[model samples]
Target: MRRARLTFGAFGAVTSIGGFVVALIAACGDDRGGFIQNERAFETEHEGGAPDAETCFLQCSLDGRSIIDSCTGGVVETCADDLACGAAKCQEPCAAAEADRSSNGCDFYFAMPRHYAPSIVSCFATFVVNASNKPATVSLELQGGELDVSRALFRAVPNSTDLEPLEGPIPPGESAILFVADWDPAKPRSVGERVDHTSCPTEAKPALEADFGNFRSGIGDAFRLKSNVPVGVTWMYPYGGAGTHYPTATLVLPVSAWAKEHVVVNGWEATLQGIPVTQIFAAEDDTEVTIIGTKTVSNGDGFTGAAAGIPAKMMLSKGQFAQIAQTEELTGSSVLSNKPTATVGGHECANVPTSAGACDTLAQQIPAFEQWGSEYVGVGYRPRTKNSDEIVWYRMVGGRDGTELEYDPVKPPAAPITLSAGELVLFSARSNDAFVVRSRDAEHPFYLGMHMSGGAGRPPKVPAYGGTGDPEFVNVVPTGQYMSSYSFYADSTFSEHSLVIVRKKTHGDFKDVWLECAGNLPDWKPIDNAGQYEYGRVDLSRQFGPGDSFGDKRCTTGLQRMRSEGAFSATLWGWGAYASYAYPGGMAFRKLVETPLTPVN
Candidate 1:
């Protein structure tokens, strides 16, 4: 959608009439009289007989802007983007075009990090999970890199402990894990060498300026996964089993979800050298990205320079990407691009709680700023300790200024708080605790994310932050964007894996939600006393425990399926001795606004 405005003649503007100018700022500058939306009919002349999605959206935006232009207008800009709540009511299809961006897509871009890996270890995979009825055929290709390399790629069969080598395409309900690179391969592999991708490489070796282009797939190069069927994508780095792992993972949304703009977010602050990083990768050629709300970042490609809080631009070709890493957290940075592009935010390996001893890699493909939601139910992850609360970290990024935020049940101390555009609030949520976060209305959208800090730090150990798992990151799926069904996969490298589900209790078939292998969900508890939403957890790892492996083992590898009449959201989280990973089940990646799709994930 084009940037919209709601200028008013009488609201905070000086209109000159026959050499007589009247000052309205002092008389009408009291913040627009509470931002009320009154829908009125307007005749929109379209070329064809009826309005389609584009025409419908155009008319709706214009109708909203027209209404606000007649009102006090100083504060009613949020409604100009959508017809749903912005002064104009649109049809279901038109709203879907604007609101229902999901995860199904044909092309995806990913570049595993050169984490703060002090030592070397085997990196398990970057997975592509198929959710479609038809089989998913994929190609894991890299720019300027050899094809059909001697890599570790396997088709994971859900429900069973089967990691089948992928010589053929992914089955209808299966996923493939491609080991692109290992941290410390048996031997050093060159850019042209036929070996797997890199694990977390130490920043010293190859150095950020040089070796990154060789292996990091950033600035100069990138890895693109082209697929025949829409599939869900995720990546886990250095996923060694048990005590040998220190990992982080993120769910990759489809190209359809990519927008021309984004807001950057990252984990806690760390040492000057280990701060968070924001990545910008192109979906097509001739793409240009402009950044704002950021600190000075050394130009990765040397094509342009970046300065603090000033708009900076970067140009890219088809298979290229760039990064902006800083000691200062890169949260709230604005990303604007001419072509639809993907923006990923997180840390290569940073301290979770700002100065925590152990650090781990964090990565999550961020959603477009406009795709953010106003309501979310945050269900906590597995407790890091037995009989104790898990301290999960959550951050909220305001999409608009003057956002009045609230919480249900036990209102937080910071409840009824207000945030300006690009502002953020960070807080901790305990294990087994759930919070219903929201703003007053849909016009005040915000983004919420969950971060996991490793259990009590263990010093003198190889990977010190070694309690349950190192810091992990994943975006919280909004209740408004929930899906009725999901097909996903969990890496078996972890000692334990679980799914945290949040469902609207008001749904007619709330009790009909079903997990294929686990049968009906066992525990169902309300998130708050309002009883509007409920939370539950299913231990996928325990279901396949030592002795019970053969029981549900046939269908648990990469195609675990769940369905319900009412839409619901689920997060996949798994952890090893000191390693962990998490991401949303899946979402439909519909084109946002005038965004277009290029035929095919």
Candidate 2:
């Protein structure tokens, strides 16, 4: 199994800003709102509809000064040929085009000429906004470095686990503020004052510095996150087992860095960004803290001490730290939530697409990742109900061309694909049906799920009239069984898909040998005759354990029968009521095993 890679470092900083004082200062100043009218000179537009570079540059330089000049299709030279600007020059060559189109994702607002600064110290961080119907207000937080948020109102509410919002609404078209103020008159303090220059006049030519690229702020111990296994949530549980009904497990990933955007107020190492490191455990020796289980945190505000002078702290007991040490050793062997890499591997491939279209692809395909023996687990989405017994499969259909979805049964659609570790491969549910790749262990069993329609609106809704949604896909191997790593692939950009080599442990190792067909169940039919030519790939490192359960429809199948009382919403707290935790049931029902299919390119 591949070890999880650290993607974004956890950096944060928190400083105080008075209400009236900040409002007054902001009112008096003409903030140099970072605007990207044209993408970088060298960067191409992913949508393939970007205006000409000359047109964009002309529009951007209506004020009579070229901030960034295009060099080639991939590079941009900042500042004009004439040294006609202020101090601080663009260190890195700017893109000729305004957009980083190669990756097919949104361009960084910092890449724009309006706010290109080589370094950012005690100032506003770059804000990015997509071209949506409604504008977006980008909120800036400095976790790894120094920042102060007393003046800014977080667009999203604060959470205890981390100092950044796990989820929030960034409107289309609208814009927000992320100003950096090192010296506040009201506070009468600075991150150590270096200078107190007056605001630049709106008409004055600005300095020729480049915006501070996304950099780390600081890092430290934050929170401990624990997974919760609900009781009686669904029929997925056995009446009893060798262990207690509630299995308590703790996984910890240390926070080593943070951002020092505008909100940071003090020195580094402040627990400003309370990234959920590991779940608190009862076995810990520290009495000052207790296990609060796990809950998804939102916003960039970590739980700080009520008092201003006291530093924010969530110190785990020595025993707790020991537990962290033990679990940290688990690495690629175990699961660690909160750390995007553990939930999904985004760094496996040496190179991953960073542009808009492909960026979303990276995000969507990561969760589909699973380690072979240690964590291989099947992931079946909500499936379709059919009157015919034809082999059925599931696909990922909607969202932006590459907008990926989450796969966590608990965090459905939250992060359908986490690219913390590697490149992303988006799947069109219809064009890309789920298939089992070969397994590794013979005696160790494997598991699979029949994708159904429902939840994130990805699955087909099963209608009444004796309609059984999706296919009841059972595992090819039984408990204590094993298989080797298998390969599974489909058309990269289509929705109607096929699966081949569905059953052999050693078959279809290469992409060419496997033949495909148009209808579902590609391998069930004669492949040599008339099936299309296609292939699928699977990784075996991501394996699952017995009782390691996943299948939203399984529990919903029976639970939906009891839904006559009223239409209900899935709540985080009420997740257990909807979930089921059971040992891989008897083979007669569906063989449960350790090996599962994790789709990757």
Candidate achieving the largest lDDT: 1
* Candidate 1 per-residue lDDT over residues 332-406, each given as its tens digit: 777788998888887766666654545667788888866676667877876755676656778788777777755
Candidate 1 CA-lDDT value: 0.56
Model 1: residues with Cα > 4 Å off, grouped in runs: 1-100, 119-124, 144-146, 149-152, 182-218, 241-244, 413-416, 457-466, 506-511, 542-559, 589-601
TM-score per candidate: 0.73, 0.20
Q: Model 2 segments beyond 4 Å from truth?
A: 1-314, 317-384, 388-428, 435-601
Alpha carbon RMSD to native, model 2: 28.1
Candidate 1 to native Cα RMSD, angstroms: 14.4
Root-mean-square deviation of every model? 14.4, 28.1
Per-residue lDDT tens digits for candidate 2, residues 1-601, read 2223212110000000121000000000011111122321122121111122122111111111223221111222234432211111221111211111010012111111111011222222211212122223322222223223334312211111111221233332212122222213333434323232122112222222122232111112211211110001011101110011111010111111100100110000111111112222122234232111112111112222212222223333322211111101111112222221211111100001111010000000111112111111233321222333222222221111222222211222221332211121222223133222212222121122222211112223422212212111122222112211111111011111111222211111111221111111112221111121122222111111111112221111110101001000110000111111111110111012223322111
The lDDT of each candidate is 0.56, 0.17
Please report, as a residue range, the 10-residue window in candidate 1 with the lowest summed lDDT: 23-32
